[model samples]
Target: MRQAGLTEALSGLDALGRIWRRRGVFAIVAGAVLALAVAALVLLPVRYLATASVIIAEQEPGANTSAAWAQKVGDPADMESQLLVIRSPRLLRQIISSPGVAGAVVSECERGRLLGSTDACQRLKTDVGAFIDHVESRFSVASAGRSRVINISYQSGLPDVAQTLANALTQTFLEDQRTEGANSREVASSWLWQELKQLDQQLREADDKIQKFRRTKGLMRGANAPISSERLTSIGQQLSQAEAARAEAAARLQEIKSEQERGPTDAPSVLQSRTIADLKQQLTTVSAQLASAAGVLGPKHPSILALTREQASIQQRLVEEMQSIAASAQKAFDANTALVNSLKKQMETAKAEAGSATLDEASIESMVRDTEIKRQQYAELYKKASELETERRVLRGSTRLVSLAELPSKPFFPKKIPFLAAGMTLALIFGVGAALLADQLGARLISPPVPVTPEAPAQQVEAPAADEAPAIVPELAESVTAPETATPPPERSSHLPSVADVSILACLPRLKSLREMSALGAILQGHQPLAIPRVLRLASEDTDFQHALRDLVHELGLKRSARSQRIVVTSPDAGDGKTTTACALAEHLAAAGRRVLVVECDVSHPAFAEIMALPASPGWLGALERGTPLRDMILPTAHPSLDVLPIGATTGPVGDILDAISLDGLLAGLDGYDAVIVDTPLPSQRNDFLAGTDWAIVCVRSDRSLIEPAVVTVNRSRALGARDVGIVVTMTDVEHRSPPVVQTAPVAAYAGAG
Candidate 1:
C-alpha cells in the first residue's frame, strides 16, 4: 500500500508536465529573474589582491649567525606569546605613527570615510585596526616544515603596499627582537653577577659548616653516616663457620663411641705414650701377684688360695686393658674440647674486628659525600658565569629597520561570480515553487466546452381493430353528498328516486376540412434574453454537440452581459484544445470589433505562442520573475482588438513564484480591458480556471468522447464556486442540427390592449 501511494505521488508530479507546457509566462519570469541577478552582479566593483612574505631569524652570540638555533631554543608557546605582543595595539599604533604608513593609509581610504579630525591620530588608530584586520584576513604565518625558519606573509589590494607592509613589519619585528635580545642579555648578565656574589658567600658558609662539623665531632676523613649492617653480616658468617666446626667435632666423638660399641679394641689415642705406659705397668702387677701365690701353695694340696690367686692374675690383666682404654678416651675428649674452644675464639675475634672496620668505613663515606657536594656547587657556579659572559658578548651590536609600508594598490573583495550564480539558481527555484503554488491554489481561468445530447420522446398510436384490448384502463367514481345539500326540486331526480351511479365515457377524435384563413394584424415583439453572451462548456471534443449547445443557448435567449462577456477556455489535462479553442473564440469576437484581452494566465507554461504567433517576448511570467509589476508584463498582440498577456516570471515550485491571491488581484486590476480571454492551465494541472473568472469554457478533444468526465469536471468547477460554467468541444468534425425555437406572448401587446 505504501508503494502504491508512492507511485501515485510520483504520478501526480509527472502530471505537472502539462502545466509546464501551458505555462509560458512563468518561463519568461524565471529567465528575467536570472538575468537581473546576473546584471546586478556585473555592476558590482572589482578587486585585485597581491601578497609578500619575509623570514625572521633568531640572533646569535657575538656574531651574525642563523636564527635557527635561537628559534629552536624558545618554547613554541613562548614564541607565540611574543608574536602576539609584537602585533599588540601599542606596537600597531607606533607603526602607524610613522609618516610614511599613516599618510599612505589615509590616502588609500580617502574614497571611503577616514581621517577627518584633530584626533586624526585616533582616527588613524581605528584605521590601523582595520588595516590589521584586513591584513590578518589576508596574511598568514608559518614555519618551514621540520625547520626553525619562519615565513611572515602579508596580502593587500595594492602590490606595492603588500610588499611594503610585509617588509616593514618584518624589519620592525626583527629590530624589536634584537633590542629585546640585547636587553635580555644585559639583564641576565647583571642577574648572574649579582647571583655570583651570593653564591660565593653561600659556598664559603657551606664549606665552613663542613669544616667546623668535622672538627667538633672529631670525625676522621672519609667517615660517613653510621650503621652496623656490614659488621653483622661478617659476624653471622663467622658464627656459621664456628657452628660447622663444633658439629664436626661432636660427629667425630659419636662415631668413635659407636665403633667402640661395635667391638673396636683400640682407643682413638691408643698410639700415644701416656696411655701405653700405664697399660704396661698394670700388666706387670698382675704377673707378680701370680708368682707369689704359686710359691705358697703345694703342687697337689687342693689349695683354694692358689686357684683364686691364678684367677686374680688373669682378672688383673683384663683390668690393665680396660684402664688403658679409659685413659685414651680422656685424651681424645681433651683434644676435641681444645679444638672447639680455638674455633669459637677465632669466630668472636673476627666478629669484633668486622664491626669496628664497618664504623670506620661509614665515617669515611660521610667525608667523601661532603667533598662531592662542594665540588658540584663550584661547577654550577662556573657554568652560570660562562653563560652570562656569552650573553653579554652577543648584545654589544646595533640593529636597524629596513623597510616601511606604502599605500595599498587595491582592496580585497569576495568574488561575485559564485554569488551571482547562487542568486540566479535561487530565483529559478522560487519560480518553480511559484508555479506549484498557483497550481495548488486552483486559481485557473480557462475551461473547455461540455457536449449536450437531447433525449427523443416515444410515440403512441390507437388500435385499428375494435376487438383489440385497450392500452390503458380508465376508472370512474361517484360523489357522495349530505341529505340536506341534495335538493328535491328536479323532476328527473324524483323519477329516479335516488342518487345516480357514475359511468365511464370514451371520447372520439373529430377531423375538420382543411381551409385557408386570412391572417390578422401583427404586433411588435420585445427584446429576448438571447441578446446576452452565453458560453456552453463542451463535455467532449464533439463539434456537433458543441454547435448544438451554442445554438440552444442562443435560441433560449441566454447571453452574458456586455461588461462580463469575456470567456476563458481550458481543460483538466494537457493535449486538450485550451489554447486552440481560446484562439478560435477570440477570432470570433475580434470579427465583431469587440476589444478582447487574450491573457495567457498559465505563466509557467504557455501554448498561445503557437496559436497567435505572438512575439513571445515580454511575457507575464518574465516580468514577474524579473520582479517587475503587472503593467510592464502586459504586451499588445498582432490583432488591434486582441491583446495577449503572455505567461512569464514562472519557476521553482509553482507555489513560490506566483500566488492565487496575487493573480486574482492582477485580474481585478485589469479593469479597463473590454473582454478577457485567458488561455489557462489544464484543470488537472491547476485550478486557475476558478480565479474570479467571469466564465469558464472547458474544451475536450472530439475523438476522446469525454462527456461523463467533462460533466464530473464541470460539477467539480461548480463546487469550486464557479457560477458561470461553459464547455467547448475542440478538434471535432461532427455536425449538429439546430435546436427548435419556442414562441411566447408579447408583454408590449398586453400593455397596449389595456
Candidate 2:
C-alpha cells in the first residue's frame, strides 16, 4: 500500500507500454522528421575550407638584445591586437581588392551562377563595393593558441577559390606590415631632419643675440672676466700700493718732527746725510784742539779761542743740512697722500661701471647657455635622422608566411555520418514526444465506454380483457407458451482480456466497497449519486466499507507525524466518488475520537449543502468575499467531532476565487480540528490546493478509469508537494470482491490476471 518507489517505476513502464502501442504513429512521425533532415542536408551547398598559416616573427631585423628578449616572450594582448589588425576593414579591403583575390571572387561568382545562385553574380556585375564586402566576409583571422602563429582561413564553394583567397590574404598582410613599418620610419626621419634644421637656426640666433647684448652693454671679455671687472681689480691693487707708500711717508715725516724737537741730529734723513757727517767730524777735531791748547797755555790762550770759533762754524753747517733733509721728507709725504686719494676716486668709478655691467653679463651668459643647448640638440637630431634614413632603406617585415593554404579535397560541411547521427537522435526525441502527446489527447477526447446492463426478460401474466390487451395479447400469449430455451451467452475469448481485469485497480489500495443498495439507489435516483446522505447510509449499512475506512485512517496515523493532518482527496475525473470518499474518511476519523473538518474546495460544482440536507448558508467563498472569518462559516454536523465547510454561495468566478483564496490560511483560522480533509475537484482540474498537504488520496472508478491517467494523477500529486500519495479504487463490484489484501506485486502479474 506504501510502495511509492514501486509505483513510480511501474508508472514509467506503463507509460512506455502505452507509447509502444502507438508505434505506427511514432514510426510515421520519426520517418517524416528524418526525411526532412536528410533533404535539408542534401539541399545545403557544400563549402570547402582552406587554411594558411603565418608565423609572427618576434625579433625584427636590427633589434637590440634586450628588445629581442622581450619580443620573444610575446604578450598575449599584443597577439590579440595583431589579430585585430589582420581582420581590420582597411586590411581586408586591400586584400580583397588585389588582382589575385578579385580573380578568385570572379571565379566563385561564376561557379555560383552555374548553381542558380544569381544574387552573388548580380552583385558582382552591378556593384563592385558590395562584391568586395561579400568576399571579405568569407575569410577570418585567428591566433593559433598562445603561439605567435596566425591562421588565415577562407571558406567558399570552390576549393581552389578558398585556397587562392587564403594565400592572397596572408601575402597581402605581410606586405602591408612591411610597407607600414617602412612608411613610419621614413616619416619619422623626415620630421627629425626638419627639426634638426630648426634647431640649427635657433642655435645661430642665440649666439648672435649673446654677441649683440655684450656689445650694447660694454661687457667685452678680458681673459677671464669683463673689461669693467678687470679695470676695477687693477684700480683696487694700485690703491692698496698707494696706501702703503703714504703710510711709510707719514711715519718718516713724524720721525723728522720728533727729531727736530729733540735736535735734528737724531732724524734718520739727517743721520744718513754725508754733509752732516763731515761737519760733525770737523767740529770734534776743533773741540779736541781747544781742550789741549787750554790745558797748555795759561789765562791769555789766543790759540784756544781760534779753535773754538772754527768748531762753532762746523755746527752751524750741520744744522742747515738737517733742515734741508726734513723739508724733503715733508714733500714725499704730501705726494704719497695725493696718490692714495686719486686711487680711491678711480676705484669708486670702476665699481660703479662693474655694477652696471653685472646685469648685462648675466643676460649674455644665459643666451650663451641657450645656444649651447640648441647646438647639442641639433647634433643629436642630425645623428638620429641619418641613422633612421639608413635603417629605412633596409626595413624588413615582422611576419612571414609559414605555409600556403592547400585546396581542400572534401567539403567541410554536411558531413554525412555525424549529421545523420545527430538528425536521428533529434528525430527520435521529437517522434516520442509527438506520439505521447497524441495518445494523451486521444485519451482525453474520446469518451469512456458506458456500462452495459443486460435487459431483463418480460414476465407474462393472464390477460385482463380482450380490449385492454388487444394490442399486445397475442405477443404475451405466444411468449408464455414458448419454450424456455434461450441462446447461451457468447463465450469470452481468452486471448483478448477485458479492460477491468488488467486495470490499475489491483495496483492501488482498495479503500472501500459498498454493495449496490436498492434503498440507497432509490434515495439517489433523482439526485447526484455522491449525495452525502447516500454515502452516510451506505457507510452505516456496509461493514466492510467501515473497516476499509478505518484501515485508511489507521494507515494515515501510522504514516503521518503531524498533530493536525491536512489531507486532500481528489480524483482524475469528476464523479469518481472523491466527495464520498472524503466525507466518509472524515467521518471515520471523527468517529475515532479525532476532530475533523471537511473543506469542500470544488466551488465550481458545489453539492455538500444540498446533499447533506443542510441549510443553504454562505460557505467559504461568501465568507472570504465578506471578509468574514472562515471558522464562523464552518457548519456543525450530526457528529459532534465532524464539521463541514462547504463551498458557499457566490456569483464571482469560482476559478479566480479558488486561485486567490489561501487554503492554508482558511484551515489555520479553523484551528480546533485535529485533521482537515480537503475535498477538491479532479486533480486534472485543480491541484494547487494539494501543495503543503500531508497526504493525497486519488479516487478512481474500477469500471471506467484507465491506468495511465490515474498514475499521472498520483505522480502529479506527489510533485505538487503531497508528502504521501496513494490511489483508492472506487465503484467496485462488492458482491464478488474478495477480502482486502495489502501487498506489493509486479505489474506483469496484474496485466496477466484473468
Candidate 3:
C-alpha cells in the first residue's frame, strides 16, 4: 500500500510538472499578482475608531403582575427587539435633528482643516443629513456573551469626531426607546379595548342564548336538575298525603254505606250518636211502663186500657228515636264520600305537575351548563384584555445605557503587516490556480492534428534574435545544424565531399512520376542512349539527369580532381535501384570517351546479369581460368566506350570473390578502365568486398527508407576502408519538371547496358 501511494504521488507530481512546464504563462500571472500585492501595500491608507457601550436589559413579560398566569420568563425575542430599536431609522434621524449636532459636525470639519475656505464651511453647514449618514456608516453595534451589554463603535479619520458621534447616537437611541415605549402602550391600549369589548359581547350572547332557550322550552333557568327534583319530591309528598286522605275518606265512606245498608246496628258511628242515645233512653222507660200496663190490663179491663194507652205511646216514642238514629247515619255517609272524591282529584293534579316538571328539568340543565362554559371563556378573555390595558399604561423601555463611547488612541483598519501578508497569500493562490487552468486548456488543444496534405513544405516560426533566447521547448536547442529550408533528394547530385574525403552523402526522396524516373534513368545510362533497350532505358537521354549528375560531380569535387576510380553502389535493403544507378553511371562516364567498366557484384538477385544477357559463368572465375593475362575478362558493350562485367552463375557463395580470390588481381584487370561501377549486395549481407573498394555510394529508396538503418549502413561502410561514401535516393514521387532527351536509336540487350 505504501509503495502504491508513493507511485500515485510521483504520478501526480509528473502531471504537475508538465503543467508547470509552461513557464511563460505561469511567470506572467504570478508576477502580475505579486505586483498588485506590492501596490496595495504602498497605496492603502489607515482608519481610526472610537467605541461606546450600552446596557440593554432583557424584558420579561408581566414582571409587575401578581397572577401566576400573567408572569413571564426571559426571551431572546425581546433582546433582538431592543437591538432593532437601538438602530431604528427614526431614532437616527432624530439624533441628526438634535440641537447643536449640525454645528458640532461643521466645527469639527473646519477644525480638522482639510478645507479651510469659508465657502466649504458654509456648504458643510447645510448638509446635516450627510454628517448623520457619515457617522452612521462607520457605526457598528455588537453584544458579547449574550449579555445585556452592547458595544457601539464608530471609525473616522479623527478620534474626537468618532467619539462625539458615538456618544450622540447613544443618547438618541435611549430617547427613542422611551418614546417608542409610550407609543407602544397607546397602541396596546387601543387594541385591548377593542378585544375586551368583543369578549363582553360574546358573554352577552351566551347569556341571551341561555335565556331564550329557557323561555322557549318553558324550563326554569339558573338552577338546574336539583330544582326540578325538589319540586317533584314536594309534589310526590303532597300526592301521597292526598292519597292517604282519600283512602281514609274512602274507608269511612265504605263503612258508612255498609252501615246504612245494614241499618244502625252494624255501624258504630250510628250507635254512638247523641240523639239516638237520648231517644233510646226515653224509649226504654216508656217500654217498661207499657209492659206493666199490658200485663195488668189483660187481666182487668178499664185500668188495663189506660195503661195500654201509656204503653202504646211509649212504644211509638221508641220507634221515632230509632228513625232519628238512621237519618244521622245517612248524613255522615254523604260527607265521607265527598271528602274521598276531593282527595283523589288533588292527587291526580299533583302527579300531572311532576311529569311536566321532569322534561323542563332536562332542557334547563343543558342550557344552564352551556351558559356556564361560555361565562368561563368570556371571563378568561376579559381578564387578559384588562391586563394588556394595564400593561399599556404602566410599561417602560426594557433596555438601558451602560457607558458612552470614548476616543480611540489607535487606528483600526489598513494594518500594514496583516494586509501585506493576506495580499501575498491570495496572490499566490490565484496565480497557481490560473496556471493550472491554462495548462489544462492547453492539454485539450494537443489532440492529434490532421495529417498535412502533400503541398508546399510547412513554414517554421521565426527564431529569436539570439541563440540564448528562451525557446518554447528547451529540448530543441541542439537541432541548429540542420538546414532550415526545403532539402532536395541527393541521388543525382549527392551534396558529397571530395572522393578522397567523403564517407556517406545526404539522403533523397522516392521517384513516382515518369519525369523523375526518366531523369534518374538518364543519369545511369549517360548521354549516349544505348541501341539496346530494357524497360525505361530507351528514354535515357534526359537534360535534367545530365545537369543533376554534373551538380553531384561538382559537390564531390570529382569533376576536376579524382583520388580513386573504383566505386561500389549498394543499399541497406533491396529494391533500391543500386545496380541500375551503378550501371548507368558507368555508361555516362564511358560516353565521355573514358574506358569505364561495370560489374554485377551481387551474387543473389543478379539483376545486371539478366539485363546484360550474360551466359552462366562467373566473370572473375573464367577470367582466372583463361591463364596468366586477364585481358579477355574485360568485356565490351553496345556503346563504343562502356563495358559490362556481369557476375555469372558460380553456384557458390560470392564471399570467395571478395576474400578467397585474389582481390588485387581482379582490380588489375580493370587498370585500363578510366571508371568502374560495381553493383554490390547490401553491406549487411557481404561487407568484406565492400571494404576493399576505393569509394562507396549507398543507395537509399526514398519512399521507404528507415533512418536508423540507413545511418547504420553509412557508419559501417565508413568504418571499413571505403571512406569515400555517399547516399543516393531511388524511385521518388515528386513534381517531374525535367524533360528527357533523345540521343540514340533503340538496340538489343548485351550492348551499352552499363
Better of 1 and 3 by lDDT: 3
- Name the runs in model 2 displaced over 4 angstroms: 1-12, 24-45, 53-92, 96-99, 115-127, 142-151, 177-185, 264-328, 369-410, 438-754
The models' CA-based lDDT, in order, is: 0.49, 0.69, 0.57
lDDT of 3 by residue, 167-218 (tens): 8878888776667776876677677667667767776787787678666655
- Output the better candidate (2/3) by lDDT: 2
lDDT of 1 by residue, 477-507 (tens): 1222123422222221110011112110111
Residue-level lDDT of model 2, residues 384-483, one tens digit each, is 8887787778777678778999989989888899889988998899888888988878866884533322231111112122211111111222212211
Task: Look at candidate 1 and tell me the lDDT of residue 259.
Answer: 50
Name the lDDT value of residue 522 in candidate 1: 15
lDDT assessment of candidate 1: 0.49
- What TM-score, computed on C-alpha atoms, does each candidate reach? 0.30, 0.53, 0.37
Better of 1 and 2 by lDDT: 2
Model 3 TM-score on a 0 to 1 scale: 0.37
Candidate with the greatest TM-score versus the true structure: 2
